[model samples]
Target chain A: MSDEIVELTASQAAAAVHAGELDPGELFETYRARAAADTLNAYLWVSDRTPAGPPAGEPAATSSPLGGVPLAVKDLFCTEGVPSQAGSRILEGYRPPYSATVVRRLAQAGAPLLGKTNQDEFAMGSSNENSGFGPVRNPWDETRVPGGSSGGSAAAVAAGLAPWAIGTDTGGSVRQPAALCGIVGLKPTYGACSRFGMIAFASSLDQAGPLTRDVTDAALLLRHMVGRDPRDSTSLEFPEPIELPTREDLRGIRLGVPDELVGEGGGVQDGVRRSFEQTLELARGLGATVEPCRLPHAPHALSAYYLIAPAEASANLARFDGVRYGLRVDSGADLVSMYSRTRAAGFGPEVKRRIMLGTYALSSGYYDAYYGTALRVRTKIAEDFRTAFQSFDFVVTPTSPWTAFELGAKLEDPLAMYLNDFCTVPMPLAGIPAISIPSGLSEGLPVGFQLAGPAFSENRLLAAAYALERAIGFDSSPARRRDPGGSTP
Target chain B: MLERAQVDHVARLARLELSDAEAERMAVELSKVLDHIEKIRELDLEGVPPTSHVVDVVNALRADEPTSSLPREVALRSAPEPVAGGFGVPSPGAGGE
Candidate 1:
C-alpha cells in the first residue's frame, strides 16, 4: 500500500493529501526509506527534519493548490541550514542562512522538502559524472546514466522515491534528463522563475523548473514556482497568473516539426527518430496540424551556446574567492595565490575547462572573434524562432538526439558530451518555453518529444503537452525487470 | 589546436591553477570543442544586433528607501575565516601582488 501511494503522480498525491486520505508525514517516511535504499545516488542530502503539514482527517487549512505533498529539490536551490553544494566540493559543508525564493514558494504551497537531490558540479555538465559526490545511475539500468546534470532529480522521480523534483535548466539540463529518464521536465521561459538564492552558473541562461512524472504535475508545480520576484530583477511580470488550463483536445493547434531537426545528417538517433515519428502520428490523431518548418540557425546554436555560456560562467564564478565563503585553500601567503589554489582544488575538471575557455574568449584580443561572433549568432537564432512562431503555434522536436547512454561513455570526450545538447540548447538561447514529455520507448528506454513556443507562452505549451501526453500515454515508472539485483526477465 | 602555453595563460587569467599534464590535456580537449563550434563562423551575420538579454524590461530599479537586509551573522555564516563580524582574507601584498 505504501509502495502504491509512493508511485502516485504529484498531482494525485496532492489530491490525496487535500482529501485527508494521506498524511504528508507518512509520505515523507515512505520516501525517506526509499531514498535510503537508492542505489542511484539521487540525493546528496535527505532532510531528517520533518515538516509540519495538516493533521490527518482535517481539511487543508490553506487555499494553496498543492496541499501537503512532498517534493525534492536540486542542490542548487539554497535551503536554510541545509548543505546546498550545487554538486561542487567548493561549497561543501556550507549552508545558506536563508532559503531561495523558489524554496519558500514551494513550502508556502504546502509541499514538504524530501531532500536536496544531486546534480553536476555548479550545474555545468550534461552528465552527472561531473558531480563532486558521484554520478547518479539510471533507475532502469544501474549501469547507465540518468540524464543530467539534473540526473539525480530525474532518477528520484522515475524510481518513485519522490513524486516530483525541482531542477534548474540552463541548457536542457531539465528536459534532456527528463526525457532520458522517462518523465516530464519543463524549462519555463527565462526569468519565469526567480534566480535569487540559487547558485550562479550562467546568469543569463539559468532558470529553475520542475521535473515530474507527468505533464499535469509539471503544470501544477510550475504554477507555484513562477511569479514576479523583486529579489530577481530578471523575473517576469505576467499579465495573468500562470495557470495550466485543463485541456482535452488539441483541435486547431499548429505544431511545426523542424526539418533541420530530423534531417539525415543531423544528430537524431535511430531509436529517437522512430519514437518521434510515432508521437507525430499521435499528435495528428489528436487534431493538431503537423507541418514541416525550418529553424535555419539551429545548427549554429550549440556552437554559440558553448562560447556564450562559458563566457558568462567565468564572470559569475569570480565570487568564489577564498575569503568570503566556500572551500578556501589557505596555503598561499597572499590573496591571488590563495584564489588560484582554492579554485584549482575545489572545482572539478569540467568547471576548470569552461572557465579557461571563457577567459580565453573574453580576453582582449580574441573577444570579437569568439564571444562577439557567438552573440551575433544568438540574435539570429532568436530571429529564427520569431519567424517560426508566426506560422506555428509550437515547434516540435525530439528532446534529445538519443536516449540515455552508459555512465562515463562520453566523459573523456568533451565535444561528444556537448553534442548531446544539440537539440535542446536553442530554446535556452532564444529564452523560450519548452517541455519534454515522455513520447514513447526506444529499446526499453524513454524518448522525449519536445514542444517549444515563443517567450511567455507556457500556458498554451503545457495545455498542448497535456493533450498529447494523454494520447501517447507513455509510462513514467521505471522498468521493473531491469532493476539491479532483482529478478531478470 | 590550442597550445599548452595558451591554456596556461587562460588558466592564469581565470585564476585557476592547472598542473602541466592537465594543461596539455585541456589544450587538446578545448581544441576539439573549438573545432565543433567553428561552424558558427561560417554564417554571414552582417548587421544582426547582439542580444544580451531576452526580457523587454531594462534598467529595472527599486526606490531609494532602505530595507531590511540579511543579518551580519547570517551573512558571514559560511565564511571560511570570519574575523571582527566580517570575512577575513590574506593581505594582497603577502603574495607579492
Candidate 2:
C-alpha cells in the first residue's frame, strides 16, 4: 500500500482513496508515520494523528477531487484551535479561535491537513533560514536550505512530506522557495485567492498560492483555493472554481523574453542560463513567438520592494503590540517597557530589521521621502509589465538567479539574500500571476523557470507552465531526504 | 555617523532595544540603506500623488457587527497576566510608587 499509495501524486492518491482501492485510515497513517520521523524542520507543529474523514472507514466527500489527501498548511495561515506560531516567539501559543477562509474551503472540500509547516517569521525571508525553529534543511542536501519563507512547505513537498502544501507568497516568498526546492509553485493573480486568514506581510503584495508535485494537481488545488470570501473583503468576485486554461497548443501564444532579464554577463549562473535557454527552445518548439523586450525600471525592483514591503509590514505588524495577542513580556515599570521588551524578545532578527526599516520608511518626515517614492517606483515597475505585455502574452525568466545555497551562507548578509528575488519580486508588485516550475537540474541542484502573466491571465500562465513542464520532461523521482534524521539544517 | 542616542531613539520608536554590537552594526548597515533610499529626495513629484496601495481599489467594509461571543474566559485563557475584565498593564512609576 505504501509503495502504491505513497508514491502517488496528490490527484492520484485522491483517486485511489475515492475508488475504495485505498483506505483513508491507512493513507492517513502512512503520512503520519512519515511526519512522525520528521527531522527536516519542515513542520512547525504537526498533529499526532488525523481522523480518517467520512463514512468512518471509507473516503468521505464527493465535493473534493483531493478529498482525503494529506497536505501541510503554512504556519502563517490562521487555523482554528491550532497553535499557529508564525515562526516567531511572539505568538508562541496563539491558537486563533477561527479558521481561515482557505482552511474552511479545504475542509469543506475534504482535504485533510497534515500539519503546519514552518516559515520565516510572519512570512519575511527568502531562505527559511530566518525561521526561529532554525532553518529547514533542503530535502535535496543537508547543508543547503529550502527556499523560504515558505521553506517548510517547499521542503515538505520536495521530500514527499505531504503531496502538496498551501503557501503564502508576499514578494516571491512562495515561488522563490518553490524554485530553490525544485517543486512547482504558483502565486495566482493577486486578488484571486482569498487572504482572510493568511498573516499579512505586505497587504498589496501578499497572495496565497499552492506548491505541488505537478501543474495539473497545482491547477486542481488552485481551483479549490480561489473565489470570494466575505471574511476577506480584498478578495475579488470570480466565477466559482475559476477554470484554468487547458490549452494544448501555444501556436498563438505570444512569449516575451526580456533580454535585460536574460543576463548575458556573469550575473546569472551558466547552468541556470543554459537551462532557461533550453526552456525557451522548448517554447519556440511549441510554435510560440519568443522575443526580447525591455522594462527600463526593472533594475530598481529590489530597492522598491524593500521599501514598500517593509513599510506595509511596519503598519500591518503594528497590531501585534505586546497586547491583545502574542508573547507578552513584563519588563520595567510601565506599559512602554513591557511592549518594548516583549517585541524585542518575541520577533526574530529579520522581522525586527524590517519592522525598524518599515517604521523608518513610514515615519513622518521620511514618509514623503522613502515610502512615498518607492510607491512611484513600484508603479513604474508595474507600468513596465503593462507595457511589455502590450506585445507579449507572457514574460519568462529564471525563477531565481542561483540554486539553493548553504543554509547559513547568506543569512548574515541581508542584501545578498534579498537579491534572490531580483527577477521574481517585480511580478507580485504588479499584482500579476507568476509560476515557478522545474526547468532542469544545474549540476546537482534544481533550477526553476517562471512565467509571468498580466492580471487575470492565470489560465494562460498555467497553460504555458503545463506545456513547459511536459516538454522539458523534468522529474526528480528519487526523494532527496529519504532519511530525515541525517539532515543538519 | 549615527550615534548611540539616535540608535536608541529609533529602537524606542520600534519597541526594540539593540545590544551594543547590534546597534553599532545596524547604524552602519542602516546608514547604507538610507543612502540608497534617500534617492527619493531627487525625484521631483510636487504634484504626483503618493500611492500607498497598488490595487487602486478601495476597501469595501462594514462597521463592526457582533454575532458570536467567546464567553469571556476562553478568549482570556492565553493572556500572561490578566485583570478580571482585561489584561493588566503597568502604569508609569508604579514601581517607584
Candidate 3:
C-alpha cells in the first residue's frame, strides 16, 4: 500500500490516509523531501518541515476528501505569511497578510500547502523566462521551456514533485503549460472559482484551476477547490458537492470540432495532431459523436485578447505604486520620481512592456481607438462562442500550436510569446469553462486537447473529460525537471 | 506603424528607459505586432457595446470594517532605502533622466 500510495491520486491518497493504512504525516514528509531535492527549482520557498508525526491540528475534517494530500500553489496566489512574490523583484520578499481564498480552501481541505512554484512576474509571459527567479525547465527537456506562468507548477507535477498543483489561467497560463508538460489542467467557468486571494493581472480574464497527473486527480482537487467565497464577488453559486464518475459514464456525449479553429495557425504538431485525431476516434468508438462546426469570430480572438488584457492590466497593476506594499525604491526627492524609481526597478521587462502598451491603449488620446475598440471585438468573439455552443455540446481544439519550444527560443520576441496563448484565450473572453487533457505526444513532448462548455457547465465538462481521459491513456513517464542526483540531462 | 519617436514617448509614459539600440529594435518589433493587430479595425462593430468583463458581477466585498495594517516597521522594511517620513522614490510621471 505504501508503494502504491506514493503514486496514488490526491483522492486515493486521502482515502488511504482516512482508512489508517497511510499516515498524513509520513506522506507530508515524503513530498517535502521530494520538493526539497533541489533539482527542479520548482519551489520558490517551502515552509518549515512538518513531519508525519502529529497533525498541526487545524481541525479540518480528517476523513473528508483530499485529506492530507500535498499540493503546490503558484506564486501569484497570495499565501498568508508566505513571501508572495509572483516571481518578480517588484514584490520582492513581500508577504501577504492573508491567504488567497483558493489557498485558504486548500488548507481547510487538509491538503498540506507545499511551497509556491516559480512563475512569470505578474503572470505576464508564456515561457517563464520572464520570471525574476529563472525559467522553470520542462521535466522532459532541460533545454526546453515548461510553458508558463504556471510553468513551475506543471514542471513540478510532471517530475512527480507533487501529485497536484494549482495554477491560474489569464489566457493559457494553466492549460498550455499543462499541455506542454504532459499534465491534465482544467480552467473552470470564469466564476466557478473565487479570485479573492489571486493577485490581479487582468481581473476579468484571470482564473485559477488545477494541473494534475490525470483527470481523476484534477477532479478530486477541483472538487475541494471550487466554491463561492464571500471575499470574491465574481464567484458563482453552483450546486454544491460536484462529483465526477469513472470513465464508463461518458458514452453518447457530443463534442464539436470547430473547422475554423483546427485548421488555422497550421493547427497542432503533426505527432500531436495524430494523437489528438486518434483520441477523437477513440471517443467515437465509445459512443460520443464528433462533428465539424463554426466559430467565425474566434479567428480574431488572439488580437482582441492581446489588446484587452494589456488594457485591463494597466489598471489592475496600478496598485503597485511606491506608496503601497511590495518593492519600493528611493530617488529624485519628488513624488513623481519616487513612483518612477520604484516601478522601473521593481517590475520585470515584460511587465513594464505590457503596462506601457496597456497605458497607451487606455490613455486619453488612444482610449477610443485602441482599448475601446478591442472591447467591441471581444463582444463579437463572445457572441460567436455563445451561438456555437447552442448547437454543440462542447467545442474542442488543440491546446497550443506545438509542443514546448526550447527555453529562450521565443523569449527575445514578444509577439512570438503572446501567440502561445492564441488558442486558449477565446474561452476566457467568453466567460466559459475549459479543460485540457493529455491527448498524446509529439516526438518526446506531450500535446493537449481542449474542451470548452457553457458557463457553469463544469459537471458535464468534467464528465466528458473523464471519459476522454481514460480513452486517451496518455503517458509521460520519468518527466524529471530537476534530479538533484544529476540523473537527467 | 508607430514611429521610433512614438515608442520612446510611450516608454517614458510608462516610466521605462531603453538604450538607443533597444529602442530601435523595439520600434521594428512593436510596429510589426501592432500591424498584425491592425486586423481588428476591420471588424464592422458599428454599434456594438464594449465589454468590460467576462464573469460579470458587482465587487465582492466584506463589511467596510477596518482591517489591521502592517506595523510601520515590517511594512516599510522592503524599501530599498527609506527617508525620514516614508519609503524613498523617484520623481513622478517618469523615471528620472
What's the DockQ for every one of the candidates?
0.77, 0.45, 0.44
Q: How does each model score on TM-score? A: 0.96, 0.94, 0.92
Q: Give the TM-score of candidate 2.
A: 0.94
- In candidate 1, which residue pairs clash? none
lDDT tens digits by residue: candidate 2, A71-183: 78999898888988888878887998777888767766767778899998899898888888888987777689888889999988888778789999988888988888889
Compose the digit string of candidate 3's lDDT tens values, residues A111-167.
778789999889998888999988887888777998888999998888877878999
Cα displacement (Å) at residue A467, model 2 = 0.9
Query: Which candidate wins on DockQ?
Result: 1
Q: What is the clash count of model 3? A: 17
In order, candidate lDDTs are 0.86, 0.80, 0.80
Could you give candidate 1's per-residue lDDT for residues A444-489 as a string of tens digits? 8899999999999999999999999988988765542234234223
Task: Please say which candidate is ahead in DockQ: 1 or 2.
Answer: 1
Recovered fraction of real interface contacts per model: 0.83, 0.43, 0.56
Candidate 3, residue A384: the lDDT equals 85
lDDT of 2 at A321: 67
